[model samples]
Target: MRGSLTTCVLFCLLSLGLSYPMMKGKPNDTSSKPFPLEDPTHNLTALADRCTDEGFDAMTLDDQGLIHLFRDGYSWSGFRGAAQFINETWNLTVSVDAAFRNHNKNQPQTHQRMYLLQGSDVWGFYEGHLLAGYPRPISQEFPGVPDNVDAAVECHAGECQTDSVIFFKGDTVYIYSPMDVPVVKQRHWAALGPCTAAFRWLERYYCFKGINFTRFDPVSGEVLSTRPLDTRDYFVSCPGRGHGHVARQNATLMSIKNRCSGRPFKAFSSDELGRTYVFRGGWYFRADSSKDGWHAWPLSHSWRNLQGEVDAAFSWENKMYFIQDSQVTIYRSNPAYTPVQGYPKPLQEELGVTEVDAAFICQSSDVLHIIKGNKLRSVDLKQSPRLPGQERPIAHTQVDSAMCNANGIYLFHGPSFYLYKDVEEMVTAAEPPEPGNIAATFLQCTE
Candidate 1:
């Protein structure tokens, strides 16, 4: 089956490390040889690509190939905070701050500050005083000011901006500036909070804080949904109280539940089994227990210890694959009840799978892409059993991250990661859209 260009690029780079030329003139096709499973220390070409020096606090792949990276930058109040979309080729970035200063002498400074950026334009929102104790919305939209407005204010012999309190509510952004003239009007807008974890499914934006989940429309800034649960509950009790995982199978707004206690759901793989299994905080769990909800059959008499924390897990062809401590571990049958002999050994030792802190696994056509630690690698399961000992480095980069959709794999590098159409088809072929009455368009929150 054909693979992604990014995958091909990675394979070529790996081939180069093995002294194999991937270009047209190469004599031997050593690329098919299995990677060396014994070598521990391997040489990787220093990443030639220049990445952002400021580093990224968070990164995600957009529908387009562009990478959306949130970076923390310096601010006026000696308080440093994140600036969104600092760099983007496909994804948009916005900045959040609680310390923006307004310089108007007549205005009393408030404490709210937020900045929204789309493409090259920016909208600075502040809630504080503007002139002589009279409260006003301090903004740069006033005429005669430079389109790219950067202002500094002075207060109490110290130079600073006055307006600092500002918050964003979808498209209807709000600013609160305190002034001498107190207007006794209740602001219906919720207080601006910290922007931490974020995820995008269709038009809805998902933000999380531990177990508390909130959904908003990126365009309209309207609050859509909020669930107070960690990653497990976020997927399980998604739609509402009564909604279960069965109804979520083929629906656009589907929900999966943790009907069984102790066992939590892991990554979902679109494969032949159509069986969804849960990992009980470890690599072991009851096998094929889709009916019992728990302890249907112990795959192994003793749980197989991976020797490290599990970072990623998926199943294909009735086999379970997991990444732990940068090493790939595959089990022939579910770990709960399978015999020791049923577990497969590590696929390759030279994949340089270390530093694999996190992962998002998806497929392109028949090729499986493992995205972790800012790099993407393609693994062919069809060929996995054939060369039980061969190993190869798929791809490596310091500038990109990957996400999967039905159409293809989204690669986010530097400012932008574009979508490769073919890769998306394989990943979404068997998977169904998340179930719910997801609004076709997210309405901007004006209230």
Candidate 2:
């Protein structure tokens, strides 16, 4: 069923409050005791006994994409309150002595580690255990950051140019960036008041107040219009909450044929969310850099109307375009995936293409590449009317789907995918690289 790092001196100028352990201290110290190599025997009762319903002490997500909730307890008892956030319910497993921890996926994979903050000491945690020789002094690791701050979280605001670690203490906020000195600022949202804990999930920032939380913009420091929601209802399972797990369904196992066996309806990457959407038949598979792997969801679950299957899909100008039959549907790239009003226009009227076998738009350009049979037409999305450019021949006789990202374009044909360095190579290459199996490459499946 369920399962569950570097130097200090050189990183002094960098952001503190990182989840990754900083430095190795004396091994003789009790605080530096090695964490258990295996998970402590899961005792849900231990958490219930300590549960005052005061909400989580700190929250963070690990590199594996698992959300961790920490509840405070005696470090000496080796019974630190920690639980795994699974399917909107808390599993009273995992235990760690961290007042608060922060994990940033933006860091290089090597540096994408977790660190635990306990008083003035910082420790490194990996997998389910704490690294040996940890418990380093916060002063030596994070020079100016005040220890035992109210809450700490890593957030990347949409309007802001850089990401930062926001430390909340009383009514003050310390914004820490790796490239610059930490900047101190005062809280502006009086409605939410000071935060007890903060977390980043799916690119959204959440500030926790006791058992309640409010969605806030880290860059503007403005609380959202929506009213505060209870963390107990949203983060964990509680009786009469009717907020968590009630709407969540367990993942269904996909049949072998559906896992990656046939031609895909459409495949496109959303740069904003850093996830790829591969649609086929009535189901869509979501792939990302998280350990959650690939899971299929009904098309209507996320995208409303225009269901059954999509002919082609691509993201442009912060909106998602889905082509089906002779019609095109557009949606905003937000959590709701709200459909744009007055959509489902004729494909010819919108993109100047009657039909499309596949479509893609590179990150750097506004040209929308539409493929039908062996012909690929380029349309300048910047220009009015969006007339189609001269049609060109592609290396492939036919493409099942097309997706573009920073790396280049991927042409999916049948069960195989061809990766081209760019649109030029995609259209000019006489012999593309040996096609890779879609199931193995995109779906992370293998025989």
Candidate 3:
């Protein structure tokens, strides 16, 4: 068996700390050791050679030492890898299962991609350039879907032109539109083998099990046909996957212990242009999805004066902010997306802000809002020295974090949501009284 969806799903539940108990099967007397693998396109070295960009759109080497490139469009294998080949003169579209998403984001134009879980941290193409991204917790982002679930995502299925992605958990199936979007739109339970791979051909979806395959009705979620998967047909649909995990008669699946290893970074964030910058220790590396392989770059030198690992960072108005300790350094993005000249401004001296744990910008105004605890403050670019009216308190228990979209402020306390409008009020209103201050309003609102 190349992959055991059974094992993959088990890994997901465990990673989430789920309480599901696993049923054990008696060990089969027939067992085999791991088989040898070949690098036909030298994808391993090719990945390293590409450096700066670690994007493997599509290519694979089979047991025969035969090299394969992106012939169709995107190719993916669950928990293993995935790739997309766009920018062909024809401007073609194809479906592939890109299951490993540590981080996911959509740009202004809806150019989206998901980062993989292993070997290559990020995998996907951006603007005809394959760009790699940072690992994100997919289980948390998509709600019902797990990070390890194998997906069969297509841009057009039946009458829908937007991308649609399918997910499987145990015997259940999930369907989603705008394939790259992080939300789950639909789900269903099916009577079939744990799905290892799924593909679309001749207007129908064929989901493959270990030895059997089921053809599904694209629109109704009906299992149209269940039959054995012939080697030739299986090889045709998933060459990239086939090359990585060879089909063997008695190969046991890799254990869950193996999945949680070799992380490139501890935290990640993306910018307006859909570029994800990763940080680990004191070093920073841009996971350029438009390119391939990982040749990491040291970070201490880029942002002069500011050293030590970054506590947290975000993007506002196309400029990148790097925060370390109580200080914050600003960097301008260049053509290469690396930090350019003029930086290392003190968070307190430069913006009249200090002890900043989180940050964002109001789309409606030119101010950059900085937050620490339940307090809220804004730095108006037009206004030089920060004034009293620019700072106010958000009446919350403890402000864990905050964010801004076209809508006003969103304050998060634990798992609860509280929205506050009028940036002026949030920054200018007198601190709402605390303890015995407004028992009537507090008790009534709580009730």
Q: What digit string (tens of lDDT, one per residue) describes model 3 on residues 372-405?
A: 7766666775676764234466665464445555
Off by over 4 Å in 1: 1-271, 278-280, 283-308, 334-352, 355-366, 382-447
What is model 1's C-alpha RMSD? Answer: 24.1
TM-score each candidate: 0.25, 0.66, 0.35
On TM-score, who's better, 1 or 2?
A: 2
Number of backbone-clashing residue pairs for each candidate, in the order shown: 70, 4, 17
Give the lowest summed-lDDT range of ten residues in model 2: 1-10
Error of 2 at 392 (Å): 5.2
lDDT of 2 by residue, 1-447 (tens): 000000110111111211111111111111111122232443455433222356666656454444455554312111223333321232223332233334433555314456656566776556645566666786665566677666777755343446556777666776765444544444445555677777654444667776666667777668863566544333443333322121123222233114544445465554456668877766565655334222344566556654667778888877888888899899887645789999989998998879899998888679999999998999999989889989888888888888887667899877788999887887787876898888777655544
The candidate, 1 or 3, that scores higher on lDDT is 3
* CA error at residue 412 for candidate 2, angstroms: 2.0
User: Would you list the C-alpha lDDT of every candidate in the order shown?
Assistant: 0.29, 0.57, 0.40
- Cα RMSD (angstroms) for every candidate in the order listed: 24.1, 11.0, 20.1
What is the TM-score (0 to 1) of candidate 2? 0.66
- lDDT tens digits, residues 175-207, model 1? 233444321111232422333334332112344
Q: Who is ahead in TM-score, 2 or 3?
A: 2
* Winner of 1 and 3 under TM-score: 3
